[model samples]
Target chain A: MKKDVPYFDKVHRWGRIWTLLALVALFSVPLVFSLAHDAWPEPGPFLKGLVAILPLYWVSGIIETFTYTPMIGAGGTYLSFVTGNIANLKLPCAIAALEKADVKGTSDEGEVISTIAIASSAITTTVIIAAGVLLFSIPVQWLTKSPVFAPAFQQIFPAMFGALMASYLRKHWKTAAATVLIGCIVVFFSPSIGIGILIVVTIVAAVLTSFLFYKISTKKSAAK
Target chain B: MDFKSNWLMYLLAAGVIGFVVVESLFFLVKAWKRGKELGISKQTLVNTVTNSAIYSVAPAISILATVFVLANALGNVLPWIRLSVIGNLQYETVAATSILSELGGSLTEEVTDPAKFAAVAWGMTIGCCLPLILVPIFCKKIHKKVGDVVNKSSSASALADVVAAAAFIGIIAAFVSKSINGIEVTKTLTGENVVSSRAGFLSIATLIVSIVVYLLLDTLATKKHLVKFSNFVMPIAMFTGMGAAVLMTQLLPQSLVLWSWPWLPPVQ
Candidate 1:
């Protein structure tokens, strides 16, 4: 027997219309805000920049939406992809199964586990982001009047980025080394090359090094 | 002065927490009803929803905590650097405040003396994090429903499968809206005295466009290559976004610091 299509798919008139309207309304929000605002200064360059960033945000959203489910449901994906799959041999499938609700050993138990996992993740994310936005941004303004405190605090972004990147680098030694080397060599000379160029170039360098390593490893095996 | 004055932020957080509790209860109820219909014990449904809700939020919390640490730290650091760069830069404060206002609600500057700016800062940070807190809760509800369907049938129907996908998209749209609104309000209302409000508008517009272009190129390149390699690009997209955000913050680096500091608390 053929699989039956879902009721939701079968053109529920109200839901379809509402979803469509929501899409349209949401898409128009930024546009409407843009039009209503006064003539922006040197609007050309700035508007260009905002336009440039929109797709990145959009894509980030798309990736984020999917990535969380998988990650929460399955622990091993990160384990295998990040580390060289040492101790976490069974985890990737387990986590994936958990998220996809295809848990092994028992079907009933698996469904319960996966469903709860997704719900809790959603709740947690919403709460933290909202709280973070309010709690952190406020003190930022108060410090502006202070002479000593304000400047001391400003290094957070670079520091955080540095810390995050550092952890990743520590995990993958050669690629990280090569990326830093390339970034520093190029960006040091051309400070104006901007962060985007620095990132793109560094990622390319890392990928190249990975390729070279792969080639070397295969050749060594063949020689053996 | 009173808690009532700050009730909005509290209310927002409370609403989110409430949603999680209520949603979990609703799922449990549905699960029980379904189980009864299928002749399973109500206890099974309760156990299932309770377990599912708890498990789902753990990772979401982890990710949120990571973001909070980064964002709050950034908020703290931005102002100091911005001030150091442009010392006593006469009342760029208005520009900064306007930007904050454009982003969402106006700075409580007028009501709270600029001397108490720190307190106001605290308030805004709490308020801004409300959405981050709320959206994830909804994710769990959707997850539970999906779990139900999957349990009843051997596999999830396409529609059920897509609910998470759809909800995730909605969350993204909400985020973008929040960001854009912030920029426009900051530029239009708060920064009005400095230059044309349009300046902020136009500049943010350009920045957004650039990010989109960069992402498109990055995504297309990923699609053409090894699947694993392509997947790696998602984090790169986030990295690019941070780079873009940092760049924008640089424009009025002080404003970026002021508003963002609370969001990026120190991780360790």
Candidate 2:
């Protein structure tokens, strides 16, 4: 709490340091594993794999960073990107925490809440995965693959997004509904459309829908 | 060299996981302090943490399912480290398969050769390393620009909220649409790519069940003023919806829809 420096500035400074540390830590895993095993990669196949995948991976990476950083706030972005599971886990957790705290993403309070929420989610996921690896690898693997628990696990996306849609749509039906309709139409026709384009299309529609609703409400009030 | 579940590999995985856990704790405590400084109540922050943890449970289990699949060929330590850190199930499989295929091996086959195993590890790491390198460089500038737009006007702020809500709706629509259109090629967490038939009806049913349960919870918690019910809304809704999925599979005709995702095996 440096009284002189703005909170955002402090957060950025801390975020950058931690992010760099994370990078070092992550890169070292492969580096050290290769060293310890006395097994360096064969460059021919490695580069071939890299060539096949890096282009698309980098493109999605750039897109996600540009789109998701601001939405989740700074600290949350730093942690979520490192922890992985953005769309499925961190983003939703941060959004729910924001809604619960009743703070806008742009607010200072919102930044803290999003950070706390994301950090908590990351830690919990880490611990759970660690435990799964350590204790019950055999049982957990069998259980997840079991027919009875399989469907429940398979529907995680629906279970999550459905709850989110119900909450957001109930509040902003006009905007959310229009966006969902357009998204469904496009996605149904071509289910392979990347999420990047879907988000761009829906954002444009949602903003326009909101503007249209405001105009209609204003005209009605003026007439009255 | 046997690359499967060696002590050294387990130690390395634990080290990476441990480092990340500490990083998360650092952020958590720092942000918790920052919230106090910003005049938020301790109770609210605690509740947010609690709720976020609860919200993460189901998805975390699903992630573990992915780990299991990857571990089949690559061994436990590699998949554990990859998925725990930055390698998502999708990207990890794609990267691993790319390298394995390039090496004239398949994901179903284990890498008895340590050099090939190390190559696969490098493939997974480097493919997903872009954001790790790029975010720290560019995120601050992006965040500031967004804040400028958000703080520009009252109307702008309102639009920003719409933007966030739209993200949610858009993704849900994409997911549910996959189910509705009913001919999606989905990658199971088990690393199998298969064409799903009648999954649309099942997903749509689950989505609707989730929505209805959420509505019921909302009505009870908010309008009916059952304040205690508020905290459990998300977890409760998600679990019930999942339960409904299993039930729908049992009740629906097997010809039309069965509890047959991983059960249907692979059409690919």
The lDDT for every candidate, in the order shown, is 0.33, 0.78
CAPRI accuracy category, model 1:
incorrect
Which tens-of-lDDT digit does each residue in A139-211 have in candidate 2?
Answer: 8888787887878888877788787777776777776667777767776566656555566566566667766
Candidate 1 on B19-85: residue-level lDDT in tens? 4334434433432343365454444344433333332232222333333222222232222212211
Model 2 C-alpha lDDT per residue in residues B1-94, reported as the tens digit of each score: 4556788788788788988888888888988988998899988899899999999998998898788788878887888888888668778888
Instruction: Give residue B32's error in model 2 in angstroms.
Output: 1.1
- The TM-score measured for candidate 2 stands at 0.92
Residue A149 lDDT in model 1?
A: 36
Best by TM-score: 2
Q: Model 2 misses residue B83 by how many Å? A: 0.7
